[model samples]
Target: MTRILAAALSSALLLASASAETLKDTLPHISVTGEASEEALPDRAILHLDIVADRLTATEAVTENERKTRSLSDGLVRQGVPIDDIRVVGVTLQSVATEEAAPRGAHGKHVSRGFRARSELSVTVNSLDEAASLLSRAIDAGSNDLRGVEFVVSDERTRLERLRIAAVKDAEQRARNYVEAVGAKLGRIIEIDHQEAVSATEANGRTEPLASASGVAFLRLRPGVRRLTARVSATWALSR
Candidate 1:
């Protein structure tokens, strides 16, 4: 019985290996990667603000924080910012000593600032020219921390499609370069896969990891130029 079982296992292994060999590509092929990018001025500005309050008691801190948020919202509404455009994405309360209240290295050992309340605010401001002024106004309306503004394109679907096409063309060119160098001909593409899309605000293509094709990344998007980068991996048959 043991010998019979061993024979069956050996046969199964041989059959599986044969199946894998049959599926393996025997044709000569080349694999290459391509990348491309395009830049445009961001069309929208999203402001990030933090309203924070510290007091002897948690209730007092929370109440003060709430008042500041209301003041900020009302001020923006008065400046023609729509109510729907202002959002409070997060809120938190904690007992800790902040750096501003401490003197250098004194982290929380001897200094206590009491309970702190914070509200994270996200505001959409459409006018680029008004961004600087909006920050000033937000401060006066009770924002304690200016986290910075995110500039984005309202719609990027059309632009991203262009980047992808360019990336594929770039891959083909690279494949051709190698084939021509070797005195060979480039044949039809066997497989193509979209690898990555980096939507960055700056030139370095570093910042946030974009979500699929539309994820957000912070790059050098300085005031005028934002970059959208795409990459593709592809395989092509080598023509004889």
Candidate 2:
């Protein structure tokens, strides 16, 4: 009975697909796909780093790492970052074994080398002005590894929505242009399929860039022009 039910569901899906394909192929329409992305300056930066301490014992390593983490957080606050924005994301204590650090046994086995304690930190900086200083302070305070600094637009959802709107408009315009070039008129839209659409709605709000206060250039890092793509395939009827 289970096998029979599965086969029936599969057959229904196949028939539905075939019906849709028949309409797509038989309809007198012009189909076009459009792609677009959003671009704007970054409004926020996230700094990721690890505060690591290596010692002969796990307790020593953990103690040192905790001290360094405190220092790191304090330094970031001093650099104008909000205390709440700094986060200790993860902690790890592990014993590492190295051929050179550990002694070789009779059967070529290795002994305990060292214990490393690491703390991961994620800091969100609202203003880019404090990013460099905060990063430098983290290193000075005992941050061992600099993972990466992510530049981001806080209105990411809205930006993606705009990209989808743009792509839809692009497809519509393309269909119109094609019909016009062929001496025909574009009629009603038959199908609108977003192939690789991001889950976003149309947004009307837009941000205006602030003008520079001075002619002298200050090194400001912004998330450069980014392409967020939304692909749309649209079919429209053509009238002669």
Off by over 4 Å in 1: 1-24, 96-113, 180-188, 196-224
TM-score of candidate 1 to 2 decimals: 0.67
Q: Summarize candidate 2's per-residue lDDT along 61-132 as a digit string, tens digits.
A: 999999999988887787678899999889999997764443555344466778999999999988776665
lDDT (Cα) of model 2: 0.74
**Model 2 regions lying over 4 Å from their true place:** 1-26, 37-39, 101-109, 182-187, 193-230, 237-240
Model 1 worst lDDT window (10 residues): 203-212
lDDT per model, in order? 0.77, 0.74
| Candidate 2 residue 110 C-alpha distance from true site, Å | 3.1
lDDT per residue, candidate 1, 1-240, as tens digits?
999999999999788666544433776788889888877777778888999998889999999999989988999998888999999999999997644456677754446679999999999978764555566668767899977778777666677788888999999999999999998888866667775464555633223222224442222224546677778888778887
* Per-prediction TM-score to the true structure, in the order listed: 0.67, 0.65
